[model samples]
Target: MASSRFSAALLLLVPALLAANRPLYAQTVTAGPDSSAVAANPVADSLRRTEKLFGWRVTRPKKAALLALVLPGAGQIYNRQYWKLPLVYGGLGATGYGLYHYQSRYKEYIKGRDLYLAANGRTPINQLPGAGDQVKKETSVDNIQRGIVFYRRNRDTFIAYNALLYGVTILDALVAAHLRDFDISDDLSLRLEPALLPTATTAPTAGLALSLHLK
Candidate 1:
């Protein structure tokens, strides 16, 4: 009877041991909460904050060029390059001088040519007796023609150069304005010095040394 009771107790203890060691499965897991959705992304979050803080905008090159076209060196001034004002004014002055000189020479050529033609017409070519008068008239006509050609060439050259100068001025203004926005910070620096070196001699030897710093 004692053996029978012991066998029944063993059977009951076996089920309890299995229940204690077996893995348990819950019908539903209760997670407290996930907070990653509320956290900010580092790069995007910083960029958004920066955009909101500073009201930075880019300047248009075309607008700056147009401003320069309307007034010489105005765009350079707008770009904060005040030193270029003298150069702009000097270029315009030189071009203006070239135009004036060309105009004066052209007018002189025209007057000289008209006078030569009138003189030739007054004396008929057939009435010239000797080879000398014929040679003189031909020489005068050639001189007047040469003068007109030279004057016209000079005038055209001056006009072309003036146009090129104006175009260059506008281009310079645009480029200056475009470069004004460039970051020009110095982040690194270097220094060199002469140092005394330890030696066997009584006097120390001087040697060059370099030092560098970065930010």
Candidate 2:
């Protein structure tokens, strides 16, 4: 009888102790709704940033554009516009060569501009041993520096043109791929035909008429 009473008293005391400690323990707990939202915000922001950089793009034109930006002719190849590859390569090669050529000339002019002029010198280009005949007309210290500026500007221009061509290649691929599925059969066309009509106050007589119809 004494053991049974001790067991019943232990069970009652355990619940009373837990009830008294519940408030204090709950104060230390951080699994509440506000805390959970705050914790999840960082993960949400990380995923959002990742999505901004590498979101899904499954379209052919989009893929072609990206491929063209990385590789010039690859997009055209993807679009089955193999003939455009030659034009792309040709424009790039020509602009690249022009940029190189102008850069070399600009460097040479810079060197010429830095040379000290002698009192007896007639012209700057004539004073230099290996100067080209092109600068002989404007052969002065100031003129040589000006030529340097001109050639440098030309080099920069060619570089810009080259970049423009690269961007055009990408745009061409995008447009071509986008229009690949467009209808181009004989059923879709314009036909011109002769037509005659009477005006409000005039009769139709030898009037040149035109009509356009498409299916």
Candidate 3:
């Protein structure tokens, strides 16, 4: 009798135990992330996965461009291309120096011309701002005016050069980043083969065919 009572109690306890664990089982099934849902949503998937540079998640080209825009040579450094730094800096430096030189000369000529005119033709051309014997040896108003124009033009040219070189460096960084994974292996090949060509005259002709293979 006692055994039968214990068996009845166990039977009741089994259903109660199952009822208590059912919600927990369902909770466990729903707790973790749903990979299929994440995969189905492209924006969520992209946000979940990212390419990183310098601990920041960003595409290579975009990162390189941002770095380059923030500071020159930073992009090349990020790309691990140390050699290009010299060329980039050299071009910018040369253009910057030329800009400084020409701008100074242009300003000097302008000042000299203004001073000559202000003195009401009494100031000797040689005694002008830039024509002070120790500086530029400009002797005539015509020569001073010509010098001003020449220096101004050269300054403007150097300004263009500086802008061009700066842009080139930024573009180089962007392109280099894009081509970082490009394949230039020996698998690329060109071949010449003989082929038959059909003509409108209903005759077949022999021809040499050139084929390019990329693998």
Candidate 4:
């Protein structure tokens, strides 16, 4: 009886051990219509293939620069140079401020000249007064002319500076993009050495030699 009981227990334990050792194959049973549709779609497969072919795996420095030329700081952002964004914005801000101030002053000068002429309708020779009036009118005329000239100069300066800023920003973007993939390693080093030599002369003569190396 004990042997029969042992045999029965062994049979039960054998099934349990077999179940534990069996590989659990997880069959992905898709029950939805969407899964079937995706599996049957040829367009999606083609799109995936196209995406793999033309994916985001390369950077173009010239294209980045062109994008920056279209919009400042964009290329730097693309190149992941967050620190340079402020400099680019600051340059554009300065140029814009200069232009605005120049325009405002120019407009004020024009308005003042127009009002003065309207009030004093082209002063004739007889209407020309004593030294004080003469000086006052001459000063007004000179002030207006000076304001106009300075405004034009400032405006032109702003334009030139803005153009320079644009060019520099584009160039900087191109350079940054090119350097984005640069490799810097701990193995790089630069060394400089100097040697001194004494020459047999009447007095003590010395010669110096320098050596430089980069690795």
Candidate 5:
């Protein structure tokens, strides 16, 4: 008899538990975002923010500038000005080569000058610092000093050239992005037409009329 009572109580409790959970499930479903609302604003839903450098949005002038700053030719690529890439890289490459060449020569001459000065301008040609051939070609203390000055000047000039070229590339990318949508077609034109001009006198004078047409 006690077992029969326990079974009856269990059946009653199970129904009560299921009934309580049903309301909680209904509330959860109701609190969820409405599918209809999401579908209604398709454009707003479709738009999404992307990761960009320095908090700048991609495909903008600032983005182009930032990319150019980070990478040598990145800005031109971003701005779709592929033609300028060759010019930018070529100028940079030439300047870099020149800088290296001049710097190396400057160091060679500097070593030669130090050797000459240490021996009171009487350093032997065989003891000078440089290639065997270069030492033979210019062994005088005066000549070594002149070479040092010349090579240093050229090295500094190439450094400036590299800096200027890098700045130009970045600026070009920014300007190009800003002017991407500008209209420069022949359809937008200015023309001169003959027309009658009203003058202070009673008679009207004929003159050429200049007009601008923007298509």
Candidate 6:
């Protein structure tokens, strides 16, 4: 009985195998992507051009940092970050103006003190360059001295602050350039939820956790 069943199964399989092996109509039915559609796409063409343009590339971060170190705001310009240029220049310019203004005030105080001394039997006052009529008011010696101390301290403080600003500009350029390609896009998402999870103590526990998913 088993031999008879085996023969019947072979008979059923043989015709199916023969049918599978047999070829159908010879008409060609090739299926593939349409090359013309890709070629005709404007967005694809633009992307191809961009790829070709960047083929001859140099290191961007290094170049940006170098430009910034050499000249304040130059790095931002190289990175095509135009908005930062004003801030860099504004900081440096304000510092320069402050140094000039405080120095001028210090000179005025000195001239006033010297003029008062000259009028009271001391040596004649030595005129400072571009010293205006600010000393003509004849303020007291103590007031002139106090002005000198105040302006000098302010001037020194601003000088140090300016130096720090210069360093900060270079650092900003370096870090900004390094992170220029960092993705801060709308694809970023965060989620928080309460859930129960099994812990090492073999008991289910409720916990709070944060999750971030970036697309």
- Candidate 6 wrong stretches, greater than 4 Å: 1-59, 118-131, 183-186, 196-204
lDDT over C-alpha atoms for residue 35 of model 5: 17
Top candidate (lDDT): 3
- For every model shown, what is its TM-score relative to the native structure? 0.51, 0.56, 0.68, 0.54, 0.64, 0.59
Better of 4 and 6 by TM-score: 6
What are the per-residue Cα lDDT tens digits for candidate 4 across 6-45? Answer: 3354346434433443222223235322222122222332
lDDT per residue (tens digit) for residues 1-215 in model 1 = 54344335434643443344322222223221211222223333233232111254334555567778898887777667889888778867876787787777667656655655666657543333332332334445566567668768777766766666677667777666545444434887776877777789899898876755434
Candidate whose TM-score is highest: 3
- On the 0 to 100 scale, the lDDT of residue 87 in model 4 is 85
* Pick by TM-score: 1 or 3, better one: 3
Model 2 gets an lDDT of: 0.64
Candidate 3 TM-score, true structure as reference: 0.68
Sorted on TM-score, best first, the list reads 3, 5, 6, 2, 4, 1
**Candidate 6, 1-215: lDDT as tens digits:** 54344335434643443344322223223322211212222233233222111254335555666677788888788777889888889878977788888899888888677656656734323343333465444345676688889899878866865676676666666566556545455887887866666688978798875655545
Better of 3 and 5 by TM-score: 3
* C-alpha RMSD of each candidate structure in angstroms: 35.6, 32.0, 28.4, 31.6, 30.1, 28.4
Error of 5 at 196 (Å): 7.1
Give one digit per residue, the lDDT tens place, for model 3 in 1-215: 54344335434633443343221111112221221212222233345334676687877767887788888899899889999899878867877898998898888888878888898878787765444342247667888889888899888877876776677677777777766745455788888878777788888798887766545
lDDT of prediction 1: 0.59
Model 5 gets an lDDT of 0.67
For model 5, state the Cα shift of residue 58 in Å.
Answer: 6.6
The C-alpha stretches of model 3 lying farther than 4 A from their native spots are: 1-56, 129-136, 183-186, 198-200
For candidate 4, give the lDDT: 0.58
Q: lDDT values of the candidates? A: 0.59, 0.64, 0.69, 0.58, 0.67, 0.61
Cα lDDT of model 5 by residue, 1-215, tens digit: 54345335434643443343221111112221221212222223123223276664454667777889889889899878899889879868977898898898888777766766777756586665543455446857788778889889888877876776677677777776656644344787888988778899999898887766544
lDDT by residue for model 2 (145-212), tens: 78888899888877776776787788778777656644433665454545555678677644544433
